[model samples]
Structures are given as C-alpha cells and as structure tokens.
Target: MGADELSATLWRGRRQLDFLLFLLETQLLHLRAGNWHRLNFTASELEKVLENLRFESLARGVEATALAKEWRAPDQFTLPALVEIAPPGVWAELLDEHRRALVSLVKDIDGAVAANISILEKGPDEARAGLDDIEILATQVNIERALAAVSEASLPFLRDFLGLS
Candidate 1:
C-alpha cells in the first residue's frame, strides 16, 4: 500500500477498535445493571459490531502484509517498514501515542470480557441447560474469539508501527 493508503488503513483500524471498546463498555454497563434481557440484546448487537471489526481488521491485515512484503523485497519502488513509511514526526502526530494506549485498553477489555464469561458459565446448574443461556454463552465465546482475532490482526501492525514486538 502507498503512504496515503496505509494511513487510511491505520485510521480505519483505530476507529474499529474504538467501536469495539464502546460495545464492550456498554456490555459492562448492562452486566452491572443486572439486566439479563438487555444484556442478551447487547450480546446480539455485539455480534454485529464484532463482524464489522473482523472485516476491518482483515482489510487492514491485507494492507499491512502487502506493505511488509514490499519492505522485505527489492522492488524498483521500495516500501519502507511502517515506522519508516511516514516522515519522522508524522506517525507520532497522527496516532498521538494512542497506539500504545490501545494496547492497555484492549487488555483491560479482554479481562472484563473474561470475568463476565466466568460469571455466565458459573450460573446455577438448572440455568445452564436453557437454550437461551446456551446461546448467550455461545455468543460470549464468539466475542472472545473476535477479540483474539482483532488482537492477532492488529498486533503485527502495532508492533511494526511502534517497533514494540
């Protein structure tokens, strides 16, 4: 990807991360309210948000991989590593140090999601068999998987961008 394309891709990925964070925060609120019905609906909505995140992450990954390949190969037109792609000060300006901040935020969200999953899984034996509860559990599992996917997709990008890995 060209510089502008790469910049756009990073921007889009960050926006998707923001949306995922919002959804998870909302889920936490519903959990705190002990509103199972609303929580169920929130889980359903989270499914949709997760789908969008996956799509965005996938596209971002493709672009980043393309750029990485270019960085590795000897082409007539060289592609720099992500950190070298922009001017010295441009990346720092554009991302505003938030990429590192996002690392922490994602970790916090993962912990919160896991805690909720534990609570859901530990409900009374009688409640476990209900299909609705099972569906909710399944959805929560999917959310966890999606979170992993987002991390897997974005980590390489962040690592290359921040030289963190």
Candidate 2:
C-alpha cells in the first residue's frame, strides 16, 4: 500500500484498540455497579444499547469495523490485551481457574482428538494414547507455573482495571 494508506491503516488500528479499551472500561463500570438495576451495561447490555443506541454510536462501530478491515482482517484485528481481564495478583485464583480449565479442556477434548485421529490416520499406536495421557498429566502439573505466567502478564491491566492508578 501507499504511505498514506499505510498510515491511515495504522491510525485505524489504534482507534480499534481505543474502542476496545472503551468497552472494557464500560464493563468494569457495570461490574462495579453490582446488580442490574444499579448497573447499565455489562457486555450483555449491548443488545439493549444497540436497540436504543443513537446513530452516532452505531456509526462509530460500523466505521470501526470497515476501517478495521482495511487496517487488518475482519476476524481478529484487535490486540491481545483486550481479551484478558483483571490482574494476575489481584485475582490469582480466577486466573488459576482459567488455566486449569484450559488444561482440562485440552486433556479431555484435544487428547481425544489426537488419539482418535492418530489411530485412523497412523494405525493403532499405543504410544499416541500414552503420550496424550502424559501430556494431560503434565499440563495439570504445570498449572501453577502457567498461572504464575498469567499473573505476570496481567499485572498492569489489573492495576488499571481496579482503578489502582
């Protein structure tokens, strides 16, 4: 692309990140608000907001999406920071829960997928199943390590989310 187009793409990507941060801040507000009556928009409140939203808000999202496609693909243009929530230290237990849940899912679903697909593709091999089981066990054992990593990654965001700033 030309220099101007590339610069515009970069600008749009930054705007996309800002929009994500806006949504995150709104969510934090909703969560801190307690009940439904007290709080306005948790992410779920999008349906209502969309239904009643002014053209300006609607237009911003559409512009963001179209510009995002120019900037990057429609599937996943935003940075990884938006997907994560809270801080590692502030909510280590929750972080650990997510890690363990992932490991558990991998053990149950991926383990089965590998085992069954390997048998069909590569013939009956005890090693595949045995190693799959080993992987599951190893992931379980490494949960603590994984959680520590998660905490380290999430500290800055956590501090910001909790208004520790």
Error of 2 at 138 (Å): 36
lDDT of candidate 1 vs native?
A: 0.54
Model 2 worst lDDT run, 10 consecutive residues: 146-155
TM-score of 2: 0.26
Q: What clash pairs does model 2 have?
A: none
- Cα lDDT tens digits for candidate 1, 1-165: 644565577677667666766766676665556544455466666667667766765676676567556555333221233444444666535544445555665565566666566544444334335558667676566445534433333334444444445
Residue 100 miss distance in model 2 (angstroms): 34
Which stretches of model 1 miss by more than 4 angstroms? 73-81, 84-98, 124-165
Candidate 2: residue 16 Cα off by (Å): 1.7
Model 2 lDDT tens row, 1-165: 322332343344334333433443453343334222212233333333323323333343454355445445445432222124223343334433433443343233333333323322332233235456765455333333322321222223222322233
Best by lDDT: 1
